[model samples]
Target: MDCRVVVEAAVPVYDVSTADEAVRIAISKTGEMLNPDLNYVEISMGSRDCPHCDDELEPAFIAADEGLVALELEMTVFNVERDEHAARIARKEIGKRLKNIPLEVLEIEVLEEEDEEEAEAADEPTETEPDGGSGDEDDVLPEFEELIDE
Candidate 1:
């Protein structure tokens, strides 16, 4: 089974002003930490809502030239036995890159293998011939093969 996992991370950024700058710096810093190793992971700004009013809030909070930015990291885990397994794998993999950053598993979505297979099947072209031929003549030859034959 495959699962899509979203993990929330609290990344700390220093010497920053404004929530936007904090979030941008945090994203760039996180990407640098994960690159050349776990480059497949997708990083985005985390969403936060006020608990009392449910009003949308900024992903970063700045205080005294320091900021704690909320970021969401998404990655897909393949061939896992269960959703929990997938989440664990994702956390472990991401944690290794972002050391000392707090991580929480926000969401785990199981990907349906059947759906992927069905979509792939739908994309394949049918090999039907209107003139009752075997359709062998319609087969495309590889460019290298054609060159070699010529």
Candidate 2:
């Protein structure tokens, strides 16, 4: 089974003046840490809301030239036996990259059969002609043959 895991990370950024700047710097730092190996992971700002009024809240908090930004890192874990297993794998993989950063498993969604099929179909290459002609090798233009002959 495949599971889509969303992990919340509290990333620390320094020398930031605004919440937006903190968030941006945090994201860039996180990306730099997880590149080349886990490049498929999607990183985005974490969602926060006021408990009483349910109003949207800023994902970053700044204090004295230091900031802690809330960010969500999502990745799909494939061929797992259970949801818990997938979550553990995701946490371990992400934790190794973002050392010392606090992480919490926010959500784990099991990929449906239809979703898997759709993903597979999208990955499969489609055969098509670039010039809107029939995809047949015998249909090559004679001008192209002249170039090859030369």
Candidate 3:
């Protein structure tokens, strides 16, 4: 499936007195956290209003708080399958790399998925057939009637 993982995190900056400084530190720290092996990775500092919102979400940073600002941030994992497992793996790697930084991951969201089959699966109801015959209740044996009663 065509999909991308977006990781949201809050990083606390120390010894910084200006918003720009906080951003610089955040970016640098995030760059260190990225995996060089990944095909594509993008990191950005989020605004106080909406942290973790990437380019797709169009995040807006209105005010830059100084002095130990916990900047909101996002790391997008590209060229990966659009699934929970991939997202978790990416999250773990990010957490491992950012162990030195006072970072707290907020959430991992699916930023984009370009898979038609996955979209259809979400909208379609699943169907299954009994071993003996069609899904009709009579097809189930008396001993297994209770199992499929629901």
Candidate 4:
């Protein structure tokens, strides 16, 4: 499948060397007002209720620029498996965590799967198969991934 998950959300960032520092600064910025502790975010894609294994579709792989001290003014998660329900939950949780920061969301675009094998599978359609027998449903590296990794 040729699917990708795209997310965009504004965040307040500060100059920090690592993700740890970035997290601290980000949290603090959002906490400058009332109920600050309520808006502490660890990662844009992570779940507020559960930190571990609770991200918006786990990243199969990742490589940051890691060039210098910096905090994220905005964060995005992309090229993940598309699920409307999950996306909704993830975004809502994130919004709550970043409530103090006041984010300006631009867009969340997803490149859903295109059944490459459809052209072939049609010739062998099942009598009553679920989702066309998952033909061409396997995840593949998104095209943009190559550009970023390069």
- The number of the candidate with the highest TM-score is 1
* lDDT of candidate 3 at residue 70, scale 0 to 100: 45
Model 2, 47-146: lDDT tens digits are: 8889999999899989998999999999999999999999999999999999999999999999887977997876665666455445565656676898
Clash pairs, candidate 4, are 5-80
Candidate 1: where is the Cα deviation over 4 Å? Answer: 119-150
Model 1 vs. true fold: TM: 0.81
**Candidate 2 regions with alpha-carbon error over 4 angstroms:** 115-150
Please say which candidate is ahead in lDDT: 1 or 3. 1
Worst 10 residues of 1 by lDDT: 129-138
TM-score of 4: 0.26
Q: Per-residue alpha-carbon lDDT of model 1 for 1-150, expressed as tens digits?
A: 999999999999999989999999999999999998998999999998999999999999999999999999999999999899999999999999899999999999998899989978766666664554455654655765788999
Worst 10 residues of 2 by lDDT: 128-137
- Model 3: how large is the Cα RMSD against the reference? 15.9
- Clashing residue pairs found in predicted model 1: none
Cα displacement (angstroms), candidate 4, residue 103, comes to 1.8
lDDT agreement of model 2 with the native: 0.93
lDDT, model 1, position 21: 97
lDDT (C-alpha) at residue 46 in model 2: 99
